[model samples]
Target: MGKGGSSKDTYNIAHQKGTPGAGGNRGDRLIKEMIHDPYKTRSKLPEPTVCPECQALFQQGRWAWAEVPPNANQELCPACQRIRDRAPAGFLMLSGAFFQEHREEIINLIRNKEKSEKAQHPLKRIMDIEEQEGETVVTFTEIHLPRGVGEALNRAYEGELDYQYTDETSILRVRWHR
Candidate 1:
């Protein structure tokens, strides 16, 4: 048996080896699943994330910046990373006869909505827009853009809107049709 203080220290060290963030913490994978609180602060990150691709600043746990930082580097923020990899966090598809007839208006509405959203939360971005034969697909860097668009369309045009979220990919799929 060791000294009382030494034995207590040993127990603490052994328990800490299995705690989260520890080198050997992988055994407790359950902790990663039930605590996906995105609103969590970024104070823990080594350095504030600044995406060189899009010049986004992750300040206060948000991707919003008035101007690029003097120390900005090419560190890809989560939004830019997803955009660069062509993996959107949210998807919106506009279809049906009404959409085809009013394509320009709908597109403009989406753009305007995005502009306002970006003004407040820079992380909300439209990754890409694809115009298909009878439908248009909009890829978003975050889930809120697609959700806002769907809500707007549903309220304004009384369109048939359906939204589904896939946890596997952490992406939201939204569909709107007249």
Candidate 2:
């Protein structure tokens, strides 16, 4: 039990940090501003909008791979915008001797994973794949896809997998080496 309350009240106070009657001090009442993504729309975009670049249909409050309906408004989907800007929300890095040896297999696995994820989610996409001096860097439009790809690689190849998520920059970095 917390100070001056039953377990349920204590639970509520702990869980609802800034809510009313949470029994917190002034600092706890202050609502922190959400981490901002510059690409995210400030307001809900009009429904049934389609991206001109990739033809991704925005309908039913989400983006999907549906056929563009008649009289749909044209707008750039976030994934295409991110691709055009080359500003990836996620990065997957592959390195080490084993990775260099099995590069083609790894890349094929990544592409397959991306294809499956992109079929379901229009926003999750691979922006680019670049080979640096000693590492292969793959960038994604959305932050979660890289992590998923890294986990898939780890599962298939038994590599060393690590993830770093930066809240300030709103990016997820996934590294896999075997």
Candidate 3:
């Protein structure tokens, strides 16, 4: 009933003509098939070079490059990859008098602990130690805390601790109070 073609015409073309190699085994069907064979030889296509982390392919058509290749590092893209790769997986947020009093001690303890533990697990890294106004924030990545790390922290410093978990990562947010 439409201007292009009727339903009956489509049905007739779909079935009546008996398309070449139709009514064949479904298991052996080609993944990508064209109306006519485009390739002269029957061979698998070559795989494109892809980033192992993000699985992004390097295509000549899509991207323009002038000798200096971009995103040479596997960690992240040139601009954002460094920040994301270096960003801490976990953070400790502290505010008020507690931060001012125990900032150095807390940082030293965490750094020492991290250094000792990193020998066993090299993937664990400390990203940053920052103090802003009355707040102190420590950021770390790939840190695996023991069972008593939380309880000991609470006992030593008066603060609230928050934690978040995702499929691939976990974030710890700690708030210290006087």
Clash totals, every prediction? 0, 0, 0
28 Cα displacement, candidate 2 (Å): 8.0
**In candidate 3, residue 13 scores what lDDT?**
59
lDDT of 1 at 7: 71
Q: Tens digits of per-residue lDDT for model 2 on 1-178?
A: 5568898876576667455553444324556666878888777878889999999998888899998988999999999999889899999999998998899998999999999999999899998899887799999999989999999998899979999998888999999988
Which residue segments of model 3 deviate by more than 4 Å? 1-84, 143-151, 166-170
Scored against the true structure, residue 79 in model 2 reaches a CA lDDT of 91
Could you tell me which residue pairs clash in candidate 3?
Answer: none
**Per-residue alpha-carbon lDDT of model 3 for 37-131, expressed as tens digits?**
11111332223333344333334422112233354323222212323656554566656566567767766766777676555443344667777
How would you order the candidates by lDDT, starting with the best?
2, 1, 3
Best by lDDT: 2
lDDT of 1 by residue, 1-178 (tens): 6566687776576566356444555333545454342433444443455766767676655567757667654466667667777878889999999988898998999999999998887778898999866689999988989999889888878879999987656779999998
For all predicted structures, in order, the TM-scores are 0.70, 0.82, 0.43
lDDT of 1 at 120: 81
What is the TM-score (0 to 1) of candidate 1? 0.70
